[model samples]
Target chain A: MAATMNDVAQRAGVSVKTVSNVVNGYPHIRETTRARVLAAIEELDYQLNVAARNLRTGRTGIIALAVPELSLPYFAELADSVIQAADAQGLTVLIEQTGSRRERELEVLSGARRHLTDGLLFSPLALGDGDEQLLDVDFPMVLLGERLFPDTVDHVTMQNVEGARAATEHLLGLGRRRVAVVGVHPGEVVGSAGLRLTGYRQALEAAGVPWDESLLGEAGLWHRSTGASAMAHLLDSGAAPDAVFAMNDAMALGVLHELQVRGIRVPDDVAVIGFDAVDEGEYSNPSLTTVDPGREQIAETAVRLLVEQIADKRGTHRPRRVYADFRILERRSTLPA
Target chain B: MAATMNDVAQRAGVSVKTVSNVVNGYPHIRETTRARVLAAIEELDYQLNVAARNLRTGRTGIIALAVPELSLPYFAELADSVIQAADAQGLTVLIEQTGSRRERELEVLSGARRHLTDGLLFSPLALGDGDEQLLDVDFPMVLLGERLFPDTVDHVTMQNVEGARAATEHLLGLGRRRVAVVGVHPGEVVGSAGLRLTGYRQALEAAGVPWDESLLGEAGLWHRSTGASAMAHLLDSGAAPDAVFAMNDAMALGVLHELQVRGIRVPDDVAVIGFDAVDEGEYSNPSLTTVDPGREQIAETAVRLLVEQIADKRGTHRPRRVYADFRILERRSTLPA
Candidate 1:
């Protein structure tokens, strides 16, 4: 039978609560008493009850990372980065998929698992406008992707608008007019899609290029199939585009496939660029050029801020907002002929 | 201040232990006593301390799903399936990436997080030969992928060998005599790569086709970059093949991309087929004909098995091995000209 706290306490000639305090790494215990307790625990082979320690210290050494879904390559890669970053901090990650749904995101915020993890690194896609109050959670949390929450929460985000502007400017500098854009969320003025769209418009405005409404492809899900259908719709409507800027790599890959099926040559008949420098983009047919949104830095910074919050037991640490750097990764898709 | 167990107990005219029992959902508590405790808790709006309840009941209501890496589309999709399946059982899933490294895989078995989660759904990519003893962990665990552990542990695996045989046979049925196989691990006889190789050989034997040594393409990591390089090596070596059977879809997509870059027409020159019906396969150029390894069934079955072990406090449940079904999904990549 495994030795319990009572056995360790009896062996160490101390009270059970004293033994628990020592096991939970309480700072008030004397060095000699701690050494005695540790010797007793080693002698009796006492396996500390993690639940009991967590109950006393309120530290689970685990964190939750909530994303839309893992099936999307960008999210999968982001999850990969977050997991690695959390691992470096000696933290375990619990992943929750919101499926980009409003109800699921709400459930994540108020879920029973809140007590199971020490903090959460949330990247919400659907919670916006009226859902600001939901971010007023008492638990230690750090938001990722964009700052859509109250100022009291720490956040780590990317320069979505600037990245999109650079992508559009790259296409415009290549002497291509009629720069089409994929993935517009209609009236959304926040979030990734909206900010990236604004960036595209800014680039077009700076270049004195007319904003052709026909070139704007509307894709709700930003999925590959949707991107393909959106491209097909634009082409079937007799809209000729010399270049396209997909909002993400997944959608860009789909757009590339659609153009290939229609017997159009990339970088000749049409140039393409995508956002989110996902690994899949590096191996795509012509390879994809995309925006490097400093994902690793975002993940590391988010975990660091969340750890800081978790460690601030008295709620003394002020919330911080950080934006990771961004750059354009030029590749074959947008290269000169 | 929030109400504690003592407050609830005093209000219900019972011992603090009785309130703890009721809150932990102990089965032996009398209906009247349970109702009184519940009423007191509701009247005081007491939030049950999950940690305290967990210490008493020894259940965390969270299971861990450990895989190699989410950057791989197969594992990402598998994690998604496992999360959904675990959610159906009202269980939270914690994801751990092992990176297919031996030390990390071993660490997962003996990690401190073992006590924090109810059980583990482990898919080890690195623990081969001489590492079987690590699976003898005290906690409840359900193994995924091929069985590499003792018979004392429950296992849920896919039909690797049979699926590969079907994939190879499909290419043979297309009148392609030189059906090259990609992603081969030399001298391997077990695991996914080895089993799939055996199936390929079996298909070739049944078809009475001569085994061409030059037609085998070797790839170590089964990644897109490696797949593309393997295809380039095979093509550069002057091994003219009429058809190619990639071991997985990621590599298959790479092969298609490489062919496209070389201006070689797919299906017109060399038909290609892949295994693992990932969603990306549906959007790749010419799409992809691959094997669907019943990933959802594997995930659901694994979670069910793990939950059973977790619920069986007496350890009375015998370990069982389950194999998910597989089938060939025909797509545009393997269409007849």
Candidate 2:
């Protein structure tokens, strides 16, 4: 059986109330009495009931981070960063995987676990139209990602369009026309895919290159396999391109692999660039060129915003939106250094 | 302000006690009354105070999964599997990242958050020496990985030695004379690195190939960068190896990238195999060949054992040690099909 306050009190030769006072850090206790109580508690290994204490304090000292899934290296690394940021503030993080599903994302915002966590750092990938009002909750929450922009909640996001534009312009600057794009979600207007596609079109217009629908490689989920399949589809459809702009690094790596499998040389036959400079890209064959989306800044800013809301307690602070700066990281996949 | 039981009662035209009964799912409540209470709850968006309910039931519908960190692909994939398994059992998982540090690992077992979770699924990477006594906690825990073996707790591990041996033997079967191993932690006898190195040596001895210490690539962490550097070190030391056995898939991918950078052809020049069949391996340049350590089974079995302990309530069930089966997944990295 686990030790209780009564066990500690009995071991310390004191009353239950005295032991409780010592455990709760009451300042009126004598030094000798506190030391004896501490020794007894350590000897018995008594644990204070955090749930009961939470009822009085209205704080759980824990935060929830809701991401799509950990299998994706981006989200996994983001979760790692959030945990480190939270740890610096002396808070624990609980992770929730929404699987990029609409229903699960709604359930997360329903405040079902509000009693257990002070606030949440939520990144919604499946919430689109008609989900704005649902984002407004009584509990403290800081939204992560470039999804919804509800004025009632704080949001931390990256420079999606600017970063993607920079990546596409980097390819165009290398004198590469007929650039192909991978991981395009048809009809998307707000998510990463849509914003990035817009940037690609802008870059093409600036370079006086015509936009060809044939060069757009449609893919779903943005996984590596999907990227490879998309590349195959583009090639099989006879859309010969001089360059490829993959939406993310995972897909970029996949595209590189597919090209290598076909014996097509990178930067010589086709140049490739991706967004989200994940660690794997640094050691990939040809060393992938990608955009660094300021993941660390996003993690830190989201935690800071969530902590602010938690401290306000009244939810009266006007919701703020913060965007992290991004940069292009040039590597061998684009051109020879 | 959040809605309370009184607000729900007022909206439903019922007493607070009746609302409480309906919320608690009492069978004695009338259907119409229950429907009215439920309607009020839906309209007001009221949530039950889970903390108070947990105190009464002595259970929290939440479990914790503690891993080294999510940045590593292996641990990220493992966390993904565990989350899916927990979801199937209708349990929510709260993740804790220990950063693979000994102090943090000890803190996780110190029962600091015991009141907030019903059980813990711990995968410690740094706990060693005299830390077995710390594993004897009063809470329900199922240890994951091969880091520790305590008689008092259930354990779920992969076939580290056997899997590594199969990988080495596969490379040797390709008529490769000198086999190099990556991600070796020297003079260790327990962890994954140590056990895998042992398997590599055993395979060499069984095949009548002399053991060459020069081919053992020392790496602190089994990350891709480390793996690439280890491969570089082996090459710089003039170890002309025909085959390489990387400890994990991430490192194997790195080794492939390193070899490609040096204009070395895979399979024709050096055959490579890795452990941990990660998803990224499927899309690598040569499509990595690795050992499938039954990750899905490990996740499912660990959750089953943990749920059983939670159900037992009295902690009377004997502990169990389960080893997931493993198999060699031959791909292009090994040899021509």
Best candidate (score: DockQ): 2
Cα-based TM-score, every candidate: 0.92, 0.93
Error of 2 at B88 (Å): 1.7
Q: How close is each model in CA RMSD to the real structure?
A: 3.1, 2.7
The lowest-lDDT stretch of 10 consecutive residues in candidate 2 chain A is: A144-153
lDDT of 1 by residue, B1-337 (tens): 5578999999999999898888768899989999999999989877767787788778888898899999999999999999999999989899999898878888888755766889999998888666677887888999998635568789998888888899999999999899999999897766788899889999999999999999999998889977888899999999998899999999998998899789888888989999878988887878889999999999999999998998898888898999999999999889988
Q: After superposition, how far is residue A123 of candidate 2 from its true place, in Å?
A: 1.0
Question: Which segments of model 2 are wrong by more than 4 Å?
Answer: A1-44, A148-150, B1-40, B148-150
Interface RMSD of each: 1.5, 1.3
Q: Give the B-chain TM-score of model 1.
A: 0.91
RMSD of model 1 against the true structure: 3.1
Candidate 2 residue B286 Cα shift, in angstroms, is 1.5
